[model samples]
Target chain A: MQNGYYIGVDLGGTKICTALVNEEGKVFKEVTVPTEAEKGELKIVENINNTIKEVLGDVKIEEVLAIGVGSPGPLDVKNGLIVETPNLPFKNFNIVKAIKDVYNTEVFLDNDANAATLGEFVFGAGMLTTNMVYVTASTGVGGGAILNGRIFRGSTSNAVEIGHTTVNIHGRRCGCGNRGCVEGISSGTAIAKTANEAVKSNVPTSLKNYDVVTSKEVFIEAAKGDRVAKEILDEALSYLGILFANLANSYDPDMIVLGGGVSNGGDIVFEKIAEEMNRRALKPIREHCKIEKAKLGGRAGVLGAAALAITELEHKNKKDGYIIYN
Target chain B: MQNGYYIGVDLGGTKICTALVNEEGKVFKEVTVPTEAEKGELKIVENINNTIKEVLGDVKIEEVLAIGVGSPGPLDVKNGLIVETPNLPFKNFNIVKAIKDVYNTEVFLDNDANAATLGEFVFGAGMLTTNMVYVTASTGVGGGAILNGRIFRGSTSNAVEIGHTTVNIHGRRCGCGNRGCVEGISSGTAIAKTANEAVKSNVPTSLKNYDVVTSKEVFIEAAKGDRVAKEILDEALSYLGILFANLANSYDPDMIVLGGGVSNGGDIVFEKIAEEMNRRALKPIREHCKIEKAKLGGRAGVLGAAALAITELEHKNKKDGYIIYN
Candidate 1:
């Protein structure tokens, strides 16, 4: 029931970002450190604790109510455990307990994608709408849904795994052991892989000059009128469109916000995906939705994690018979 | 709120099914009538009224709490209006107003599939779990979602349009003007059409002997070891598997309940779909859900509509500052 400041941590494979945020969700200070995941769980925990300490600076311990960590998932949110993240080194990492033991404050943990979606809903592109789906096409395609202004975590709190939904049943093998999942076709890794393969196959393209073609290079080449690059982008965006359209039909959200590394390829990516969505989806499904880029940018992860902490505190307070104040 | 009996009406293209249901979700009396939809909205409304009156018999009006109707949709549930049902004779039909005017009682209307899901959750296969997806593979694939023991109505109460979700980007055209939707490949209509086309295309099969091929006959033939029939069934079931897996990934529901005519093909249908789901879906996604047959059967439509009435009454009473009790 205590109302005060909160700490939000965005834990990634390579780095940890932490911020001290007030009740109104404003960040007073922020800090970051390398995860050095290969050094394992102890090193990662130390990095997280250090980042939080650096972010807090001289702030009094009593001023902070809770800490929220948005880490790589499929997490056991109920148990406050990281089940087995694809990128993170640890299995069954008890992040909440570790943070609470170190900081002596309440800790909340959620999927990084879910945290970012909440951040967008609370402070970014989706602030105007209560219902939204946030899709981040980073190294992987990740999604989170906001329904009636609350995170729509499914039965096991591991729902909204949009990337794993199959778009092409007979297509490429996904890391999750599925064939032609949207993540395998439309994510930044997928785009880069598609480009690299096209080059290796001796396709007549400017992309062949690069030893390792990134998603950025492909989009840049496509914009400059490289036919092969445009084709690659088109294929990826088409599948991304199917994914978005399916989401639109399934959830009927008011808006879809696109974020992550690949989204930086700019309006062409959005335009192409939106076009495919409009063309492929039934009229009613596509009509009410606006496809917009995430406005919170890189800050979404920390802000969202912070927001999750605040949200969890509110839920806890309500459950304990305390009245929540705006 | 006043704890009393309610009425449920399932309005379909072919028939109108009505039932008088008590607060504890028991049906006291039931009646059915042909829709005769081509005779237009007024005639359809008359049929609906007659059916409801017949179902009520000698029951006192004051004892009835409210009426709930489940009709073919994409409906405007908020306005209690049938926005534009493709099968019905009328567009923009105010069904709630019509029923309320004739009976002089409060009325609520929802999509038939949504009502059926609620019915299943409230009284059938889904009663054991709060998070569920109900798929009816009837003439067309239809779906409804139940989350946290309440209907998961999306932004416009048009959420969970599972049928329209694309299973294959390069697959068949759906009636909803989308290509490769699950409804285009897995619905009863799709099975029959595929069978009829196979027969016409000079495929050497037992199905060629029948002038009019039905989805049931195809299943029967498949059971009797007809290769063409088995192939057709396999294709349809594979698409259905994709559809189910997609739902499993998207919602992470505790259970998926299958209802409608095609499901009567029985364990083979469920088995084939489960096999495909297990093979194609990520292990964690497929591991948590049990896909089972709908227990409510023919009673689902009426019961769901009735549940909708009670639920609506509860919400209304709660909103009006009244505490509801059974």
Candidate 2:
């Protein structure tokens, strides 16, 4: 293994989390701070740097292998620039340069999805798999793929947009302006919206007891045997299952790691997905491809950023003809 | 380019086509022979050998760089074994060893879809691109992909099974025992099946004039302004569009090359696909990903075999640390 530490910065809308991690994925120190977006881009950058410095502690700068930043997209990963994102104030911001100017070491940047994918590939559910797909179904559906043991970024660095892929040709329109997208039909937000619609329609359900009903409440109600809640969950989860089956047929991955809020729905989620795979996916693929929940949970973001740094550093070393120990 | 000839064998149930090709993808000699598959496995093997010998002509066996065979799957590509396929009579047959025994050269075996993908990547529509997907929607909807300049064979060598991917979650049952597959809704066979169903239902249309209606007759009738034919094709082509759009969202490829019988349905097919893509695909992907008709046509199979030979040889040489001129 490489004898150096790595710093990972997980930049998000609500908070910034930084960690100092070893090559084997052990975290020695960590820090978290709110992302005060109202204070502007430079302030957010300062907060990120402060978190990095806090985590460094007694570790020398010279011992650090690389720094990695995982943020929301759309980003120009090649140039390490955040093109524009809804939550962040960055507009064509050269984030890689900002980090490198402060750290004086190699820095890598990628979308949060890709970072999480690397996290799974390196230390989570996909550790031993050569080809794995990681899907996160929360407010929205997003995914990343590791094919042949490397992150598969497509032509425009926007590959594996699994959420937007249509599962129903004449289905409801998605926020991406496409109809029948898996995200529109199966995401946590989508589930909540359906529940709210049912409530507005005065449908017979325990969901009406709450002033606000989300996907989590729906899951609870469904467990209590609420008919409408079960129907809504069944419809959403079935679409998710179709999406998984489609992915299996297309990628033939060794495994698919399901992450984010919806995945935490427990046995119902896995059972539905497995049933769909058995029904839709080709026999060989369905039999071989394992569907597992992500192991990292909330720490996925920070660890994924750390993994990004490690893998990028290794790739650079190999390309530069320098032999690496691990 | 490497100074050697390559032999390509396109193995099918009805006939075997062999071609001697150069590094530049030009065929110098070719031969075709009946497979005589009913005569059994040994006879088919003998016929394949005879075709290879005929294509060899005056070229010395020592000068041949490699032989590539493209056949129907379920194949054990790693072990060069034809496990079993609906077409042809091969069960766990070591086709690679059989070819190498006669020619004393490197032999590469891949499924037809992967071979065709390589052919497009090396010599056809995707020559200049690093990431491309090839879709053949004829009797069935099958495809292959080249990502990062190499064929992306999934864990089980069944990657890029686009036909089996679902587009209409509640659509029709497929022959593969899945419901709402693109193969079940949009493939030529599917189109023909739908048209036949309509004919049997006594739908008022020009399709009733045909004793044996196929997708071809439907296309002809649609072009002649028959309302029933137009509606059938419109519905089928719309689903295909959704399939293509979903592919764009998932892959974000530089291009998607459409081939096979359905693609050759002239302007209607392309127009419908384009319309659906515009409506469903993400803006960035729709704008960047070119949807083009396949260029190789009837020669795709033979040249694809040749391409498989060239690419596999290059890959092996690279892995073995041998340098060769391009």
Candidate 3:
């Protein structure tokens, strides 16, 4: 029982990654397959089940404690339903029940952000911290917090929508229809968008050498000492810094773990973050809260889903007065 | 005992308010006295003890469950020391030890903002809510939160420094040395500063008739259709709205309770807050998080201290396996 396995399913529009993870956060078996989203709802769900089956391998279903699925939202996590999402074809689909019908074990469902946060809390950079905020600076700025040793899913389970929070009162308008959202100014998509605009405006830069410029090219050009690219990154990372500083001021967490594409911008990303935090965060908070890079990289999705299962199972066992062993 | 009594002390720069509160959150006895802060550290401590004594009246010290004191920061709450604040004369003073010596009971100390948050959570506007954020907008803006039915005191107990969180990056510089902090723009002091600046600039306004302009004067003038005053309030309240919207986005709490002087500006303040929240917050969050005025009013500080004692005692009892009756 101490060596029990948990199944994790990372449901995405492009692919469904399923893994069997052991108690020690090791992947025992795993399989990844195309989601084939355009092939229709039932077909995609079938693909998910197939991946789960592939990961199960020779292990008996009884040896698995629980299954956890992480997906893009809006989701009815309490009822284990994927209400709807832009990428996924789910519309009021009961994903947990569908998985449970075949496996007949306990299942948990959460948004990808919360799952990733749990992953960091349990086995990644946020390990051992009582309060941690996991921020993903990808195409959008989204986050989740583990507070007081538990996942904090605000009143409507929409807590930690950090990207939507305003940074500059009269700054750029966001797709969410808000002005000055950090996501609108600092996310990977935003950075690339700014670079493309600069190129279209014929601003003097090495970014124009590339037929198309993305955040990846901007980072490369900035590293090569391109002034325009450097300025774009400086502005974007400064806003990112403001976002991090705001988190430090608000949560006063033990650490803020950075994840997603933009976080991988290396020294420049961390340097800007540190600079803004020093300038903006309260003295005590800045000194106390550690800023760290997320440990999980490409495998974050699958591992996060696995971590969700392990953590939720532990919570359920605790509530049911069952002792858990290492 | 279910009928237990607790002592609450609201330690402010100008006054010391002490009260005996019952299990039902009702005040049994109360006393207010001048802090005489200029009389030095030991004198302030003595004054605090005297107020506690006055509030105790004929009740024996043994009947009191615990004592809670709420004061200005920067405090070392874990060690129960007043680390030193602007108006308070105490420097590295262990006020908790002094109070404990006099009463021989458990003593708890927290920042005034956290105490007020506890007050709202236990007996005021935030009652019956599992997650609530209490924001005080006065001469300065400050706040605290009760998350998952417990006070979330981050790593260093400085959690929920919402005022210092950036609302308008590149906007006004805060006294905290951070740019665009909500406190620098939305607070009563900030409002007064803006109005006074407008008056000094000889803006065409009825505010010129007043020899001195405070936030109260600005609110009055705005209510009376003074355009300049109205503009000042609109600008300030909009930033306040951003702060509130950020809270809603980050915490997704059940409710945000507004307290202190500026919150009393009535409809104009609330309308601005609502408009900003609608314009800024995520749809799900905006639809769910209720914005309410603090119920404790002028008595927030005293009652908040009481709530802190009660909440902490409940936490202690639960941890020690002692069941709370109320």
Best by TM-score: 2
Model 3: per-residue Cα lDDT over A1-326, one tens digit each: 25689988999889999999987689888899999989988898788888878888898889899888999999888778899999877899988878877886778899999989988888899988999999999989998999878899888889999998888866678999878899999999999999999999967998999998889999999999999999999999998999999999999999999999998898999999999999999999999999999998877888899888888888887683121221
Better of 1 and 2 by DockQ: 2
- How displaced is residue A277 in candidate 1, in Å? 1.7
Q: Clash pairs of candidate 1?
A: none
Model 1 residue B72 distance off true place after TM-score fit, in angstroms: 1.3
lDDT of every predicted structure (CA atoms)? 0.85, 0.90, 0.89
Please count the clashing residue pairs in each candidate, in the order shown: 0, 0, 0
TM-score of each: 0.94, 0.97, 0.96
**What are the per-residue Cα lDDT tens digits for candidate 2 across A98-208?**
877788788899999999999989989999999999999999999999988889989888899999988886667899887788999899999999999999995789999
True contacts kept of 2: 0.81
Model 2 scores a C-alpha lDDT of: 0.90
Candidate ordering by lDDT (highest first): 2, 3, 1
Candidate structures ordered by DockQ, highest first: 3, 2, 1
RMSD after Cα superposition, model 2: 2.9
Q: Where does candidate 2 stray beyond 4 Å?
A: A320-326, B320-326
